[model samples]
Target: MTYTARSIVWIVIYLLFILLPLFALLAGSLPPARDFWTEFSAALGYSGLAIMGLQFGLTARFRYVTEPWGEDVIYHFHRRISLFAVA
Candidate 1:
């Protein structure tokens, strides 16, 4: 595949991997929270946790994933994104 096509494919896969847990939550039985804040907080917590976990893989120097963006760019993002999780 050409460079553009390969990049697109990796982007899609990355998106899918990061969002897969959220998509599963939609299918599974949700928590019994009637108030919007409670549900919203739960969703936010889940999303943050998912992305935080995936950062490890992104920084692990995987050739296939890092190839699309370059290793330095991938590690740079991992550092920045991890800070949000810390806060």
Candidate 2:
């Protein structure tokens, strides 16, 4: 499969957004002083919500984000993410 420069850029942007929270957590103070499971679960929830929101935005049909992968690919990805959201 071929990817345009814009598409490659979009991929990096998406990945960075997904990692934003982890980077935030790591770049800040140590959290071991806090409840591990509680913080971990909260982080997971926040990450999942962010991913879900991105999934919706991915369907906005913007050529810059969807062109390299195509509309069908984006829609299928959205469908898969929707299923994942229920879990």
Candidate 3:
């Protein structure tokens, strides 16, 4: 695939990776629904954790993964996303 196509595919994969936990939570049995803020907070926490976990892959420098974006772009994303995850 071309670089743009590959990048788009990777973007989709990244989104799926980050949302996997949220999908699992919805799929599994759970307690009664809580207030808006409580559920929102929980979702945010899960997203943050997923982003933090993805940091490792970002830094691993896998050529197939980095070829589309390049090392600099990947590291830049890693740094920015790390800050976002922390917040």
- Which residue ranges in model 2 land beyond 4 Å of their true spot? 1-8, 25-33
Model 2 steric clash pairs: none
- Candidate 2 local Cα displacement, residue 13, angstroms: 2.1
For candidate 3, what is the lDDT? 0.93
Residue-wise C-alpha lDDT for candidate 1, range 1-87, written one tens digit per residue: 878999899778867876777788889986675898877777778878877888888888889888877988888888888988667
Give stretches of model 1 more than 4 Å off.
Answer: none
Clashes by residue pair, model 3 = none
In angstroms, the error of model 1 at 16 is 1.9
Higher lDDT: candidate 2 or 3? 3
Residue-level lDDT for 30 in candidate 3: 80
lDDT per residue (tens digit) for residues 7-84 in model 3: 999999999999999999899888586898998899999989999999999899899889998999999999999999
Clashes of 3: 0
lDDT of 2 by residue, 1-34 (tens): 4466667787789878877977787888776666
* lDDT against the true structure, each candidate: 0.81, 0.80, 0.93
Q: Rank the candidates by lDDT, best first.
A: 3, 1, 2
